[model samples]
Target chain A: MTALIAFDWGTSSLRAARLDERGQVLEERSSTDGILQVPAGGFPAVFERITQGWPLHGATCLASGMVGSRQGWREAPYCPCPAGAAELADHVLWLDDVPGGARVGLVPGLSAREAGVPDVMRGEEVQVFGALQRLDTDHGLFVLPGTHSKWVRVAGGRITGFSTFMTGEVYAALRQHTILARTMAEGAQDNTAFLRGVQHALRAGSLLHGAFSARALSLFGELTEAAGGSYLSGLVIGEELRAQRLQNSALQPVLIGSPALTRRYALALSVLGVQARELGAEATWQGLWSLAQTLDTTA
Target chain B: MTALIAFDWGTSSLRAARLDERGQVLEERSSTDGILQVPAGGFPAVFERITQGWPLHGATCLASGMVGSRQGWREAPYCPCPAGAAELADHVLWLDDVPGGARVGLVPGLSAREAGVPDVMRGEEVQVFGALQRLDTDHGLFVLPGTHSKWVRVAGGRITGFSTFMTGEVYAALRQHTILARTMAEGAQDNTAFLRGVQHALRAGSLLHGAFSARALSLFGELTEAAGGSYLSGLVIGEELRAQRLQNSALQPVLIGSPALTRRYALALSVLGVQARELGAEATWQGLWSLAQTLDTTA
Candidate 1:
């Protein structure tokens, strides 16, 4: 059986998994030297250091995330969406410099434009594609919530387009640094407050007004500090729903992420009169592996 | 000439101005020990250090800002709206230890509740009130643009109510820390790009949507790095105007602040069909002085 390696090189962490030909994980290693942690031109050396004792006599490797960003070793051109596993594999950048005659391939991210809004998704596209492959549906919306939450549109087993909202980052900043920081009680979630905030945003009829209202409401004692984060999340997600509905009324949206993240999206969607499904987290790794399989076959 | 001392003890800066009975400047001193900089119970020492050699034996002293906050020397209770100079002066807190020394007074901020919305203004209350005293207007909106922009509604020479928007702080954070930091050129106004962004925000109808649109617009060449700051300024100011208009129908707003800050607010207000006038920078100091005058006469 042929052994393959897949790496997700993010901003702060490097996660690599070794898989057999059928994609069963054989070994996995994680390191702290993400792209931001390494010096220029140190990626090759770092990769070698991590995989020192791995059985790489003739292994093929696939990589994603900041490893393919502009600052990465080689600029991997982004594939325009409606992209699938085949398209991602076709655009992979093959590196032949690894020891033991191993070949490394970097998967390209996806970008798209809709209604004059340009969007780019890296690392998550493969997982989204993998989730879709398992969904048995031809068309749906995919929600990938994180520091920058992305709402993706998929049709015919391909990513048609997507939009991004800075929900996660905004929550972090407001909760950790702003005046709201003091008010929020630690490790508490108030669903009622969140739902109230979501409904309030919908009634406000404008996201801008609603965003400021979050601060006002908190100050006015209409919202508790512990629930301020949830309120903000609801407000952003509600605004996204308002904008997305204005763009496409027929597309059904699916959420792909951790349970908590997807639950928030699902809650927001339900409040907006839409149904959503939560895809598994493993979908991303599976999608990356599937792309690796395609790259191996094409090569 | 009888000396009057005015102190604006805000969160980040402590500014004290010595003036004659007629409000002519005598001498001024500033200290780095703002409310945030000083430890609890350190306010008295910090104040004494900054005002050394200034004749405080019988001068009527007025103070505003965080000096009235809970963390300040003592909690000066908030005065309800429809409050005048005499009302603010009457609510002032006198330091018990300095009873026979300086005729010390802390100006009471204005607070109001209407339609379940509670709004409060502290230091800027005196500034806007003083500006109104200068304008001799019985009714109008006063916009104080700063780290926390305040929109105060005055009727019959009393501060009826006000709304606070954290526009300046948000702008600083986004420009200095976020991904947009790379897109924003340092220091200088791009009027054209700012105008376009304000117009876009006005049309977008929501702050959250408008904020995310900045990223997309940058990608689409609708905005540039040098103009990113201006664009962001436009979006925030535009959204503020949109929210303000929803609560009040009058389109004319008086602006109180430095010339540059007011100009930006005026430009954004212009997009929303509001005529804005700069009430001048000296208004804050003058307003604090006005409160001092009232306290002196009453004492």
Candidate 2:
């Protein structure tokens, strides 16, 4: 029997899963009805529609990601790091009961500070926890790549700190809005060009200067338009890596996210002579499941 | 009598000046007829309209900037650095004689390469030569700040080499197209916040990480929306400065651009204990006039 219903909801998409008592996925569903697309006062209907046919009785329901943001159905205030499953569980913003007898909870996102500058993440914390459970380690480093890539560190089963790099977003803006677009060609990513860009980014100290290389290389006939996009991708991802100064570090970061992004990050990490392990959707499900375990079943 | 007719024709605006025998501006006219705005085969019409009432009879007319680009009326190939007034004069793409028996020439842009990556600039080359003439220096460092900022080095009255940084363009994209836009306010700049951003950029090692601070700082109420734009401006400008490793360099690069931009650059440079002198449109006219001096009067 399904014991918990978990959601990995974000701005542009919604994902739901039914898990057994052991946090194993029994069934799953998803939709394009993300927070941004939800009409005003429409979250309840959308939620019910996506969770239809799933046995909701006696199964605790928990939701994570921007779904808990201010714009979401219910605002789940952020829990400050270093925090782990217990802290998140303690801070869960309990929602109204559903038609079934199941208790509904919204997982609070995590907030981190470095040198007094604040950083926050909602859905990634769940993945980090799941990664810990998967890796069976109390300490680790993690990177979640997307429009906003997160570099996270955890120790003693709690998140200590993390930083966000707008690498993917910056790449899109440069390619679509800036002069760099002229050199880019559309199609599948060329890994060779991507690696070349990564190597160039690693060797260069300034992204502001290094990014121009794509345009310059194209003008000089040194790099083709077809490879420009991948090269640009490599530069941004590589810049993210360069800033971390990870080349000298002994730590092996665990990359958590979609297969394509993880593979790219893994390839980029290889340049520094570092090997990274790739984790996929299983981490998100596992993370939501781990958070679900912290909820009191007796209640 | 006008000894020369000079045009500073770039991507967005056109400015024409009539200079006397001493290279002094006698009369100036400007319009929105930048090269990009000119219609196909419409440059001659726009040019005729803008130069009306000015005697093109014997004056050698010279146009600089994107007017020499491929899209411009006539493409003047870039002159390789170390180029000076003499090199530009020798390579000028002379156009067909205009009505009234007048000669016309397009000043070629300059090109520089570092580590095999090519860098190109059009109108800024004119400003650089003009700066050299005004400063009366055989060798100096110069910065022309705008959509794309150029860092040029000159020796023996020639631009030895230069680099381009898309600081301004990147700033516009991030402020308008990225999530950071949520924190920005539209209005006059706040110098304090801008300097704060510069200081932060100097302290931080990675721009990819540092840029996020704009959002994070706003989320925590440390920076208000009103100051966000200026702070972002500082960050981009600071990143450019950081890349040049100019913090320790004794070179007080001459600032050549609009008053607003040059003032900001000077302020940013002051943080590193470096003092910079500012030049305005005088540099462009002087540079064009200097190049005109090298032209064959008998021809």
Candidate 3:
């Protein structure tokens, strides 16, 4: 039974999920060849290559993330919030004649504007909505960690507001490009050091003071290259956690991402005396299907 | 006669000044060949190239900044603070034999230990002491801007403590390397946009959120590339200033650096209702000479 094809394409990678009406991932294919790497032959050709024999014949194709960005296949306009699957389905853009007159729909990105200066997320909105569907709960703090980690607030199955933290991006930039790189050992992951980093977040100070400590600890022989790097990671993640707590102390942020990344966030949260639960991959798959269902009804 | 040979050799550049007993700059030369660029031929050869025919024979040579860092000419250990030129003079590293038996001295940098993690600065201590000597004041905040800007506490002619902000480095990284780079117009340094950034810093939020505004503003047609770049610069500088205020709102930090930078910092300070003054180049020369005077007296 062919329902639709979904994707979670982004800046660094691309992925496709074949799904049925029950919102289950029938089969999945992915590659590092993201929007950034797609050739001059364009996105349709790439999509066709990956979706070969996946029942594109009259299949409803849907895309999310940067694939809907200006740099991607087609510029799917961002739908400003307060929005959920209904608003998302209402604003999706579709591609015509995508190799077989197949209709390719793009889930619009969501923008938060209540505080004035606008902050936005493209694919994460789907993830948030998916969490809403999976948890069968209305209100929760969804933290989707990545290069740009998001802290989103949801109420009545719609996103009220959210904030983006440049933790992962800062980590990558500092690790590879800054003077602190001298003190870090590549490919080293130390959990104790990581916990120490989470603990350091309890101290009152700016990120600047905390970051320099990576080298200070290494110079003092108190932290090794691996541990120092881990501590640096903790400092960044810790800051993100602290910012959200400062904003709303009562809200417990629910983690949603891969097992590896979200585990670190969960560990950091536990260290801060906050219990965070992880959502499985099924959430996004479910979210995409829900939106597709909305598309079916709305269309 | 050449009373002293002074060099401010830091990470990115090397500068030389021949000073008389009165601390007047008789001759000056500089190059981009900082410690990081110096080859296996080493600091001595590079030093000789920059200081050729400058009465190296039996001259009292002195160096400060990263030249004395672990990767510099020779590692000069840092002097823990609550001390000034006198304490700095007491721990100078000396070179006995060179092209001539010139007694070359390396001024020790200062380290702050009150904050559990040790923070250090190599060259700015001289500038701080120099500001003290030139201003005839004992207590004030000294700001030296660079890739890592330093804010030092000076009281009773002693450098009590200081903190380093990675404002400039973060700006460079974001403008050149991050996703925000695409939204920014290269070679754009608008004062208006810069001020808007400084003003935005007053609003409550973390740096991650603040930085993303540069892109959001761009995406929404609210910010131009040039203005966006300046705004990014402002955000970084603004965060540093805000952190200091958060720590203690009463101190008026004195600015030291190139006129262009101090001027911008001054503008931002004024926007925030704080007045800051600039220290002239003579202050650093006077500071290096002042420390050398202490060395002479101690010797």
Best by DockQ: 2
* Cα deviation of B8, candidate 3, in Å: 1.3
lDDT value, residue A217 of candidate 1: 62
Q: What's the distance in Å from true for residue B83, model 2?
A: 2.2
- Chain B TM-score of predicted candidate 1 relative to the true chain B: 0.91
Fnat (0 to 1) per candidate: 0.26, 0.75, 0.50
lDDT of 3: 0.81
Worst 10 residues of 3 chain B by lDDT: B242-251
lDDT of 2 at B28: 93
Positional deviation of residue A131's Cα in model 1 after best superposition, in angstroms = 2.3
lDDT (Cα, tens digit) per residue for candidate 2, span A1-299: 89889998899999999998787888989999989999888887887899888877766888989999888878898899999889899999987745555567888898888776788888999999999999999898999999888999999999998998888899999899898987778968999999988888876677887788887788668889888999999999998998888885789999998899999999999998888999985798888787777666323
lDDT of 1 by residue, B32-121 (tens): 777888897887788778778888787777889888877677778788877888788788887756533776677777776655545566
| Tens digits of per-residue lDDT for model 1, A1-299 | 54678788877889888888777777778899888898998988888888878877777788888788776767787888877677888888888887667788888877776555466767888778678667766567777888777777777767787767766665566556556566667656667777776776666554434555666566557777677777776766676666666332444677888898788777777776677778866775677777876776776
Best by lDDT: 2
Which digits, one per residue and each the tens of the lDDT, describe model 3 over residues A39-144? Answer: 6558888888788888887888888898888788878888987887889998999777689667899888988874477888889999888888888887888999
Model 3 DockQ (Cα-based): 0.60
What docking class should model 3 receive?
A: medium
lDDT values of the candidates?
0.74, 0.86, 0.81
